[model samples]
Target: MPIPGNLLTTAMAVMPHTDPERAIQTALSLDIPFWPQLPKFDYTEDMYVQASEHFPGIVLDMTAKTLRFSMDKFLAEFEETMAHFDDPAYFDISPAYSAVYHRFLAMDHSKRKAIRGQLEGPVSFGFNIQDQDGRPILFDDTVRPFMFEFMAKRVNVQLERLKALNPNAFMFIDEPGLQFLFSAMSGYSDRAAKDDVGAFLDRIERPRGIHLCGNPDWDFLLQLDMDILSLDVYTNGEVFGSYSGSIRKFLDRGGVLVWGIVPTNMEPFSKESMDTLEARLIAIWDMLAKKGIDREWLLSRSLLSPATCCLVNPDGERTVEEAFAMIRTLSARLREHYALDGD
Candidate 1:
C-alpha cells in the first residue's frame, strides 16, 4: 500500500470522553481522524482489554475490573481459538470491544487525508497481563508467540476495515510498555524486544506505526522498519535530538514523524501557549538542522499531535479538547510560517 504523505494534525490512542458520538465527532474534526478508545465509558475499551477479545485463557472480571490469563482455560480453548485464527472475522473489533469504532466507520471519510486506528501492542499487552501463576504472559514461551501472532492478525483485520473507509487507512501499535525494555528490572532484554517488535511489524500487511509516549532507546526504535514513529516530544524532544543520524535515515527512507508537540499533562499544559510550543518545536528542528537534517524536509514529512493520550488530566475532557485545538492552530501557523501551505 502507498503510504499517506503530507498528513497534518491527529491524536494519540485514548480519548477522555464517555460519549461515543461526541468522541467520533471530535475525531472527524482532525486532518487524520482516529477512532477514540473510550476507557472511561467502558472497561472493554481499555487498550489491553480491547486487544484481549477472543484470546484463549484470558479472563475479564467486570466487577473487579481486572484481566488475567488461565493455563487451564488456554489448554481447553487452545484448539478452538486456533481454528479461527485464519478467519479475519474472528479478529474483527465489533462495537462491543470499541464503543466508537463502528460509529466512527459509519461516518463519511471520503474527504479525509487519511484515517487511523490503534491497537495495544503485543509487548505492552504481554507485560500488562499475567498468567494464572502471576507471571507476565510475555515470559510464557508458548503463550508469548501466540499473543504476538494474535495481535498481528488483529492489526491486519482493523487495517482492512479502515481501508475500506479510506484507502490511506493505517494502524498504530500503542506501546507505552516499550519504555520498560530499558530498565534493569524489566526482565525482557532490549535485543529480545527489538527482535519481537521487528517480527511483529513484518506480519502487518499495511503501513506499520508505533506510538511510544515515554522515552525509549531511540536509536534502536528508529532502526525498525516502521513507516511512522510517534513519540511524546513535549518531554522527550531534546533527548531525541541526540539521535540525529537515526532521524535522518528514517526521514530519508520516506518515513513520517508524528511530532507530539502539544502537552497533555496538566502542569505543562498550563504553562504552554501557541507561541511557546511553536518556539519549542522550532528549537528542536533547528537542533536537527544544525546536524544536517533539512528543516523544510522535516516539516514536509511531519504530522502534529498532542504529546500523548489525555487520560491523566484532572480537568477531564475539556483539557483534551483544548490540547487538540492548540494542535490544529499550531499546525496551521507552522505550515504558513514555513510556506508549506501548498504541500
Candidate 2:
C-alpha cells in the first residue's frame, strides 16, 4: 500500500475528555484528524467493551467495570452471530459504543490530509477477556476464530464509514498487550502470536497498521506485512533506534513509521520542550542515517503522535491537549527544517 500523502501528525485511540464535542474538536485540529475514543465519557467507549458490542457470549459488568466470556452463552448464540457475518450493519459501531462517532462523521474533513480510526487488536482483546474458567479467550480453540473474524468485520465497517468522509482514511489496531507475546508467563509463544496477527491482517482488505505503546520485540514487529508501525519513541527511542536494520528494511518496503515522540503524562510532559523533543528525535534519525538510511527519506516516510493514549492522568485532558499542541508545532518545524513544504 502506498503511504498517505501529508500524514505528518495524528494521535492514538483514546482521549481523556469527558466531553464529546471537545474530543471531536481536538481530533479535528490535527493534520491527520482521527475519531477520538472517549472512554472517560462512557464505559462502552473502553476499547475492549467497545469492540465487544456484537460479539457472542461476551458480557460487560457495568457495576464492576469488567468483561468476561460465558461458554454456555457462546454455544447458544454462536450460530446466529455467524449467520450475519457478511452484513456490515451487524458490526457497525453505534452511538452507544462511542459518544462522538456520529458527531465526528458529520464534521467537515475536506481540508484534512488523512483521517484515522482504531480498534483493539485480537491479541490484546483475546488476552484481556477471560472465560468462566479463568482462561484467556485467545487460548480457546472454538472462540478464537470467531473472535478474529468478528474484529475483521468491525474494522471493515468502520473503515468504510471513514472513507466516505475522506478517501485517505485508514484504521490501526492497538496492541499494547503485544509486549507479553515473548514473556514466559504469557503462555502464548511469539511465533504463534505472529502467525495469528498475520492471519488477522490478511482478512482486512485495506491498508493495515498496528500500534504498540510498549517496547516489544522491534525486529519481530517491523518484519510484519503492515503498511504502518507506530511505537512509543518518547520512552523507547534508544532501544528502538538499535533496530536500524529492521527499520531500514521496513522503510525500503514503503512502510510508514509513526514516531510517537510527545509524552502523554504530566511528569514527562512538564520536563520537555519542543526544542528538546525535536533534538531527541533528530538524534535517533541521525543514528539511523549513519547506519545507511537517508535522513530525508526518514522524514518523508514518517508521521507524528503522542507516545500513547492519554486515558489516565492527574491533570485530565489538559496533559493530552498540551501533547497534541507540541506534536503539531514539532511537525511544522520538521517540515520547514527538511524543506518538505511541497509534501
Report each candidate's C-alpha RMSD, comma-separated, in the order given: 1.6, 1.6
The local distance difference test score of model 2 is: 0.85
The CA lDDT of each predicted structure is 0.86, 0.85
Over the stretch 18-62, how does candidate 1's per-residue lDDT look in tens digits? 887887777777788998999898998888898999999999998
Cα displacement (Å) at residue 207, model 1 = 1.1
lDDT of 2 by residue, 1-343 (tens): 3345333888896899998888888887788888888777888888889889879998889888889999999998889988887789889888878767778888877666678888898889998999999998988878887788889889889888888888888889988888877777455566777787788888885777899899898888898888888899999999999999999999888889999999999888999999999999999999999999988777778998888887779889999998999898888888888788524
Worst 10 residues of 1 by lDDT: 1-10
Q: Count the backbone clashes (under 3 Å) in each candidate.
A: 0, 0
Question: Which segments of model 2 are wrong by more than 4 Å?
Answer: 5-7, 185-187
TM-score of 2: 0.96
**Candidate 2 residue-wise lDDT at 254:** 88
